[model samples]
Target: MTTAPSHPTDPTMNAIGQAVAEAREGDVAAARRKLLSLWSGIGVTGDPLHRCTLAHHLADLYEDPAQALAWDIRALDAAGAVTDQRVQQHHAALHIAGFFPSLHLNLADDFRRLGSFEAAAEHLNAAEESAPALPRDGYGALLRTAIRQVAEAVAQRDTAKRDTAPGRTA
Candidate 1:
């Protein structure tokens, strides 16, 4: 295992959490601003876990599908570079594989909104295929349910934003 500090003890992680908390507080503009500042500091080649987490949240702050898709892609790309040891260093319970379902789901949703059903289906299927890595908890259940919801929307060729989708009320 690396020498990375635990999530709460890590300064960068704490900063990311503060920004995410700001978003959860409904001050999305503030959160986006804060996260963008952090991203500038972190850069594209920063720690993969940090990149993954930051880009994932940053994607949600954008109402535009293209912008969100770009961030989502970055999140997924970062996830690919992350390791289980690095993830466990931040949170003992976190494993790198557990991040994929949500990452792919977000990408699927982004592609769906952009009217790219084929690409959306591919990522959606990847999300489902990666579901086994998800824990049997509320968060996992939520992702599973969201995957189903996204699948339904895809089947119907609906491009409108989902009311239940995380972040960015559109």
Candidate 2:
């Protein structure tokens, strides 16, 4: 999902952030291991915000489209259960609405990489429809641009992963 400043008071979120940071630093396996451990403890019915954030970041650690799709799906499912209050509790600037575009964009990208154009288009459309919820800032612009690029890829039936796709180190 959209990366918001971490709320240090929440250990789960803090751990998730650290794992994400590790993945970003090119140690994806370690990050994935750390996150999986956290996920095991969180369980399926754990805090929605924690599930959403963790799954979203965890998805980025996978190079395989199908694997990423699974975690992205979990992230989207958890996002559905997340409340604005919960999101704002983590970062005052965050809103549950603002999470949808990135969530859908990631799903669409994964589906596209898997050569599921129809499904990709469906989620790409959802991302575009939710675009207005994003702030008029860098993150908003990035997701909007990614949506357009994914739409084009879907039209061309291109299954090759984009260089920019989160095919993080394994």
Candidate 3:
């Protein structure tokens, strides 16, 4: 999974990003505590950007695939409510279109990990469909790579299952 980029100007987001970085560096417990604290501050009815950012990072804190999928869904729902005016006011460069790819990619991966290849493929398709709206930059490349990797993994797993089925010959 790719590291979430930081928004230096937003303290809450910066803190969340820092926690995520700490988690990536092998301090997951600390990161989870920090994120939970932030989540408490930004409740369910909080601003869309905060909800989206917090949920996106919070999903990574879960060891359980199902829990992570739940958080990804929350993030996607919050992203849908984030408007361009809010982005401009907050000086956030995030576009709702850009958020979909990451949210769907994460959901796809979670579904694949849970042995749900059809759901995974559906999310992968959503990610691909939203890819073109992403800015043509390194972040976009990373999202594209993640989408491809998940798609390939899902296909390989499906093929393996087919090949091992009863009465099937190689």
Candidate 4:
């Protein structure tokens, strides 16, 4: 039942927000530059929260699906390392359970985009399994809808591939 922090003013959060805004504006390269600068400060073994957030945003910057998948994997790894103390200190609920859904969903999207339907299905399943950890609010609902859409798309693509393969007819 943890609520979002009343004050979301951390430097890392601010940087992430700015980068996300830049990406949303279609300036992904600029967003990548901003995130890379922050990533350097965070380093490989930096705070898990910072690493996860940075890597997740960094993934969106890449035009290459494989590169984005790599970053999403890093984000999922860092999310697993996030500590409860860090979550409390940040006044946010970033436990692995809460983080996994989005991480897996993003990974699923990346895999689907790369035409790796099996990998995409695996991650989509993981996302669905971890979804209850998310806050039961508008954001969570939106995420759930997104997950479903991605799952449906993957299913359709897989079926289409199967039907079009040799010796198969639609």
- Per residue, candidate 4 scores C-alpha lDDT tens digits across 1-170 of 12244336578867777777777777777788898899889888998878887788788677576887788898998988987777667764546577788889888888887888999999999999999998788868867887888888798774222221111111
* Candidate 4: worst-modelled 10 consecutive residues by lDDT: 161-170
TM-score of 1: 0.94
Backbone clash count, each prediction separately: 0, 0, 0, 0
| Number of the top lDDT candidate | 2
Better of 1 and 3 by lDDT: 1
Query: Where's the lowest-lDDT run of ten residues in candidate 1?
Result: 1-10
Candidate 3 per-residue C-alpha lDDT over 107-164 given as tens digits, one digit per residue, 9 for 90 to 100: 8888887899999999999999988987788877877877887788898874222221
Each model's C-alpha lDDT?
A: 0.88, 0.89, 0.75, 0.74
TM-scores vs. true structure, each candidate: 0.94, 0.97, 0.81, 0.80
- Candidate 4 lDDT at 152 equals 84
lDDT of 2 at 78: 95
What residue runs in model 4 are displaced by over 4 Å at the alpha carbon? 1-10, 158-170
Model 4 vs. true fold: TM: 0.80
- Residues 2-106 of candidate 1 have per-residue lDDT tens digits of 122337667888888888888888899999999999999999999998899889988989989899999999999999999889888888877888899999999
Q: Residues 3-80, candidate 2, lDDT per residue (tens digit)?
A: 678887899999998888888887888999999999999999999999999999898888888989999999999999
lDDT of 3 at 107: 84
> Order of all candidates by lDDT, from best down to worst?
2, 1, 3, 4
Question: Model 4 shows how many backbone clashes?
Answer: 0
